[model samples]
Target: MHVKYLIIGAGPTGLGAAHRLTELGEHSVLVLERNPYAGGLAASFRDAAGFTWDIGGHVVFSHYTYFDNLVDALLGGEYLEHMRIARVRIAERWVPYPFQNNIRHLPPDMQWECVQALLPGHRREVAPTNFAEWFEYVFGAGIAKYFMRPYNFKVWATPAEMMSYQWIGERVSVVNLEMVLRNLVLQLDNVSWGPNNLFRFPQQGGTGEIFTRLAARLGDKVRLNTPVAAVDPASRAVHTADGQTITYDKLLTTGPLDILIRDQIGAGPAAAMVGDGMRAAAGQLARNGVYVAGVGVNGTRDDDTCWMYFPESNAPFYRLTNFHNYSPRNAARPGHQRALMAETSWSDHKPEQLDTLMDKTIEGLVNTSMLHPDETARIASRWSIAVDYGYPVPTPGRDDALRCIQPWLEAHGIYSRGRFGGWKYEAANMDHSVMQGVEWAGRMVLGEEETTYKL
Candidate 1:
């Protein structure tokens, strides 16, 4: 069958692109997906208790008005907007978020320990081109040495030294030396600019609901379970895993760029360059995540908080959230029966054994006192899924490699955009990812500038 565009991966990004195309009256579009459902990583799994768990924690925070406007256009009803009440869990202590900026909240000795080597004057003197250097420059030696460095390793499964700091643009805020010192003297919390400062979430369903509903708006354009197996760029034909071939004038690939290149264009100096970009990225990545481990405790209180982060090495999970508090339906019950969701991460190559990691995660919560070890709470069903490229690794030489690969793909008329598609962590949030699709459709049909793809 002939189509104007063939969009692969029925995730939010692809759906966004398709919706835009449909809205603009572009009918010759085919959206394909391997999964039976849309939403990709934004998809959620529900347990028998009516509790919904996002593949990973996704909050709708957008820098682009197009994304914000489109989501509102598709979405109806009251979406919850919560001020961020996040904290960092380190060394069994709950330090307010932007841990480096607020570590003064810790015990005096702990504060002194972090401040001693981090006098702002004696910080690392190197040029600090890598992530570790940037960490030292932003947080100083003590905080970086103690929390920022090790905790990141536990998450990305890579060392900071190997990472590049370019991707931290909007994802992480640089520490304020003056404010940090001032706050150290007087106990105070710091609020800073970040993408998800005040964000929205569905009132009932999880983030997946947004995508599913968005897909519904597309009518019959999406073809689920349509995994693209191969593509012949010469004739612009895509082969599905089921041995069906579809020809299109243009193709948008949301799968991993390196894999798509190797499969479609074959390996060579060009393929090696793309692969090197991925490897260079891996050196910086602390990839993989384990989530949806909850505790059903008795009695519910109004001690509502959004999400908490962990910077200490002792804590296995880097983040925790009071799910019930985010939306009562997240936990879906009241009274003393409380449920909490925490997330931990690992790497693909060196994954922590499922059973072993689960044990450690629970113990970690107990050890941290977030959950009392002695308290009896039935361990409800746990949800664990390994997102291969959960967080894109931004390392040095990445731009060089993307520069080489992107143009080559463009020459072949193939557009790759998304979280993993572009390998941009800063612009890889739910909203940004959706905008990537929307903007790509604009480029395809309207010949307008590529917005999300620009960065």
Candidate 2:
């Protein structure tokens, strides 16, 4: 099969590219997805009990007008807009998110500790090397110790010292001393911070509906359950596992750069040593796997919070999103039901018990006051999914690795873009991922310069 563009992985990135290509009046496009469904990590599934669960907590917020327009056109009136009401569970108490900004909510002594740490003139590092140093420099010692350090360690599944600080643009809320002191003095609640302060979600299905609807619009151009075994970029051909060779003028891949380099590209003559350094850098790439366990309850839930972050080790899960609160249709039972999606991270530094993960996760919810122990009787459904490529850790070496790998792939008519493809957690968000695709297609077809994919 010959096509002008052969897109790999029918997730947000691939779908976005195909959608843009078609929008530009390019018909010769084929999307090949390994899974039977589109959306990749963004996919959603309804359990046997009928509760719809997303891969993780996916909220729809955009940095680009193009992305907002795409989602609006697709979902139309089926989507729900929400004001983000997020919190953090620390010291067995609930505090408004941007923990540093809301230190007044903590006990007297703890508040003093945080305030005293900030009382000194802000300490700015001339050159902060790691995330740990960056946190200390930006948030001071107390806030860093109380919240940033432990919380980040749990979320990243790697030491804060091991990761880089470049990817933290709008993702991490920095400490605002003026606002924090004012809130403390007046005992005000400072909950508003971050770009996801307001977001949208599908009213009916989970987050996956957006992509599934997009894939449907693309129609016959999408090929599911067809995993590509290898791509001979030398001949501009992709060999499928089932013995199908697809030759393309340009190939857009959204799969993991490391996997594509090690498995598909291998040590081909186009570049023999390509596999060695890329493979070594891939091993150095700091990334953590996530285990999302969905707990469905038949009874009504009291909390109206969207999601909450847990920094302490008392809970196994780092963050929990009230799935049912996001959308009422997420409930499986007829009367009143609630669903909580808890995310647990695991890496070589932090190993997790996969077998007892569900049970432990339940215990964690109880410990964190997210679920009452007595509410266990009202449990309707329980399921867990392990996502290998959850969060791409922004290690110090990540940019260097991408700099080496991306140029090589593009030189041979292969464009790697997406969460894991680009390997940038900052731009790995839903809106950013899709725009990466849109921008990639524009660059390929219209000779436009790409912004999101720049190293």
Candidate 3:
């Protein structure tokens, strides 16, 4: 009924925070989770046919030594190391991961169009006002049209003009005219541009294995099937759906910041504590939903590709991963079976009919050359999961909103840090999410300044 530190949502951020707090000799900690299991969006599922699938395509490629050490200690030798083999599907051809860097792989006319648009003075010289302008300013009209614009719209489910460009960081591979021309002329493939070129995965379970092990270490410190209905900042108490009230000295919430501020807090007497500016800021935050469809077949393909991006509408899904390649155990039969996982995003800007998504996804696989028409009969299993909070959109007003909301929460002993809680796509990766929690714990216990996430 009481604790020194209380965490909501036993996802990576909450688990990381509790784990770090324990490491700091703080055991009076409790993690409350709404789901029956752990891992949050990073969770995995096993289908009736014995196929393993993640919520979406998640690969373990970290930017922090702390995360690396933690993963190593947890998984030990149970994980498999992999070199990322990412690609893009354009004009019925497989271009390397960075579509702009590998325009040479496109058709002759398309390649020339891209090269012509990148010629001197072809790009805008003015400062970009939004993601749309930013891409055109940096990549020109041809590349933006063929890849950046369409693919981003597909994945984010938001118009480029409505989103901010500050989150680009290392997520996008920026290239110049000279570099593009050199690669085009030299027939070179710039596959090794991003940090995820070398990654790791669980050899047995899906990406959720790491978090499952972490929650196990925390033992009974984590409570599953417990969803918080409201947070009373006045009394520093969390009311669960089942009518139990848990009081805490400090609170770290890993749920959607918008829901926490606008719905949960607004529902109670603490509503008066949240100012109009904070509520308006919460309205500015946006997110997209994702539909993950896993198709298991009786036969296997010998492709070495890890995942492929689809900018064209030929496929209903924006991305597809060869799940079987991540680990042989992911499929029912190691060598004879195949598992293809497709991810389709939706939001107010983009809507999808869920009932027919599976059929469309399979048709997409055939259209994208992942499957044949006759092979549809060989399909043994079809599994799908829909998550409402997929990617957090980095709108133009995100930073300003965070400035208005985060400080107020921190002042009230509430620290929200994670993908949806922080609402920062750039820092929402697995490593960054864990480090945000680790940094928050460090700040709480040792008075160290938080570094991974800053307003």
Candidate 4:
């Protein structure tokens, strides 16, 4: 079988490419998705108890106008506008997010320590090498020690020293000493720092609905349950699990780049040696898997809080999003029940017992007061999903590895574009991933330049 454009993995990126290609009046595009569903990582599920849960904590916020327009066009009025009500559970207190700016909520002694570290002459002159050093340099000892270090470790499943600082731009909240001091003195909440301060979510199915709706427009162009087993870059073809060989003039992959380089791509002895080096370099790129535990409660949840963060070890989850709060319809009976989605990250550095993760997560919710003792009887449903390709941790040499791997793939008429495909946590948000696919289509089909996938 032959196609002009063959796209793999019908996630946001693959769907984005298909949608854009069709919109551009091109009909020679085919999308292959391994799962029976369209949305890969963005897929949502409805439990037996009628609560809807996303793959993880997903909020619809965009950095591009195209993404916004796409989501708007797809979702239309079937979305809920939300004001982000996020918090950090630190020192057993719900401090406003951007914890450094809201240190005043801590005990007086702790506040004094943070302020002292922020003092003008108390700053340390440390040349930043790793994320730890950058955290210390930017957030100072007090803030770093109290929140940044522990929280990031929980989220990344690796020590800050093992990660890089380049992806921290716009993703992290940099504290202003003067503003922090002013907030501390006046006891003001500086919770509005991130781009997701105001966001949107689907009113019906979940975040996954956005992609599913887009995929519906593609119809038979998207082939579900077609898992690519091997890729022959020399022949510009892919062998699927069912023994079908599909040839393409150009291929776009939206899966893990490392997996593609290691298992899929076939090469000669000399190229294999180079591939080994590339694999080693790709291995150096740190990434952590996520266990998403969704707890559906039978009782009413009146709180309007969107999500919250946990820095303490008592909770196995680093972040918890009130899934029902995103949209009341997310819960089975609307005002009668609620859904709580908790996320836990783990890797070789941080191992997790998958079988017991759901139980541990529930106990953690109780420990963190998310699930009260009296509310245990009202537990409607308990489910856990482990996502293999979760957060892509950025290491110092990640960019260099991508720089080498991407050019080689481009030379072979292959484009890896998405969250793990691009390997850029900075631009790996939903919007960026979709735009990467859209731009990849433009580059391949229309001979236009691709922007987001630049290494």
List TM-scores for all candidates, in order. 0.91, 0.97, 0.99, 0.97
Against the true structure, candidate 1 has what lDDT?
A: 0.72
* Model 1 lDDT per residue over 283-346, tens place: 3323344444555455555665678776665556777777766566676564444556767776
Best by lDDT: 3
Model 2 residue 387 CA deviation (Å) reads 0.7
Candidate number of the best TM-score: 3
Model 3 lDDT per residue over 1-455, tens place: 89999999999999999999999999999999999999998889888999999999999998899999999999997988889999999888899988888898999999998888888888878999999999888988899999999999999999999998988889898877888999989999888889999999999889999999999999999999999999988899999999989999999999999999988898775888888888999999999999999999999767999999999999999999999999989998988999999999999999999889999999999999999888999999999999999999999999999999998898889999999999999999999998999999999999999889988
Model 3 residue 54 lDDT score:
96
Error of 4 at 338 (Å): 1.6
Better of 2 and 3 by lDDT: 3
RMSD of 3: 0.9
- Per-prediction backbone clash count: 11, 0, 0, 0
Which sequence of candidate numbers ranks them by lDDT, best first? 3, 2, 4, 1
lDDT of each: 0.72, 0.88, 0.93, 0.87
